[model samples]
Target: MSTVKMISLRVKSMKNIQKIVKTMKVVSAAKYAKAKKDLLVARPYGTSTKVFYDKLDLKDPQEQTLLIAITSDRGLCGALHKNVSTKIKEEFAKRPENSKIVCVGEKSRGLLQGQYGKSFLGVADQIGRKPPTFLDASRISNILFTTPYKYTSGKIIFNESKSVVSYLTSVVSVFTLRTLNAAPGLRVYDSLDDDLLQSYLEFSVTSLVFYALKEAAASEQSSRVNAMDQASKTAGNMISELTMVLNKTRQAAITTELIEIISGATAAKKDSGV
Candidate 1:
């Protein structure tokens, strides 16, 4: 039976849940602001690198490809992680055997580690626990450069935030030093050499990864803000509905008690001939 006490309890629980949701929304909003600010600063550096590569029109001769999938360890942010995983799956479909994956969060590692375990070169976990720094990106790039696996072409996959409620999964193409050296456009510059190109490659990878991390962080935070906002609103609605139900139940009980008392009093008066 639906009673006033039960309904009141449900309403109290809903209120508590709503409070938590609101708090989460506030925290996410602050995080989103910081992430967005960082992203703005990183955009120019990352874009310039991509533009330089585009002008060179470099192409890899081999089919080997590498992918750095960026995501966050924490969940509760909509499809931020799933989108990256999906993009990786699509890439794998195109080149299943010659592809390698470097997962940059626990979420991606957990998602792809099952079937793509063999394809994984490394996993970078606990990334979203704090704001990403250039040093952090350098560490990841160092790991990649040290690995025995070689790739002609590579991509960094991450979420690009548009608004608090909107985001797009994006990819940044990368190339090896060999491919850069082979570009015909590079012949115009007589000052370049193998060592310089290698250094540029390392710095380029680090910058791109740093940019991607900032973007993913911003997107994740925005997505979380939107999610928590919606959750808080839903909880508010539930609390309102539960409150109404409680009031109706309590009134019904009171009305029933009053009717029983009136009936008993009338019967007694009639029996006593009053």
Candidate 2:
């Protein structure tokens, strides 16, 4: 009976937990769908922005590098952001004495701040509070171009959403003044003034940044959906096993009671016959 009670309690708790996990899984799927739409809207802009990189490659590469990590404010996405953070650490390790880290979301900021200390260039938390937009991405992109920091190379690290259930932790490069100037087709845009070149850089960076943000968001939700689904299944299996145990234990208890009653009746009959 005690065993039955314990197992029953566990099964009850698991049932409630399964309910919560199932609800969370559904929410994550909805969020993932929304993020996919956002990515579709932003892809063309990112692709068109690449034209700037072709015409204006920078000649001077900076001694220090900048690492930009795209992450999210909320967790429960398994290791999606953690993978990006690990990549950031790997890139930081490769850099020489001078390098800067830029965090796009709360997760990266929290993870990197402890390890990198003062090495962080800045953190953009509020940008990803809602679904990423062109305006938001433009602000972050503008800062990178207008900032006086002489970073030669910049890399954006993110979880690329490959499909509903697949994602890749990937890194992409942002061109510097030197890289853009050395681009293969420099002669075509050579006539354009410095202002035009700056404008191009802004467009390229904004589109790329926005795309990264949306993709990372999509990856975050998708990963959570998958994880929660697996958790729910595991919980359900556990509940079913415990229920079986409870039933068997109940049957055993009832059988023992029946045996005791029959033994008492047999003894009473023997006494009466005497």
Best by TM-score: 1
lDDT of each: 0.89, 0.81
lDDT of 2 by residue, 20-120 (tens): 99999998888888988888876676666655563455443657688889997888778888899999999888874767888888888888888796887
Give the local distance difference test score of model 1: 0.89
Q: Any idea how many clashes model 1 has?
A: 0
lDDT of 1 by residue, 108-212 (tens): 999899989999998888799899999879877877788888788888999988887899999998888877878998887778889998998899989999988
Report model 1's TM-score to 2 decimal places.
0.93
Q: Candidate 1: worst 10 consecutive residues by lDDT?
A: 54-63
Number of the predicted model whose lDDT against the real structure is largest: 1
Q: How do the predictions measure up, each by TM-score? A: 0.93, 0.84
Q: Clash totals for all models, in order?
A: 0, 14
**Predicted candidate 1: what Cα RMSD to the true structure?**
1.8
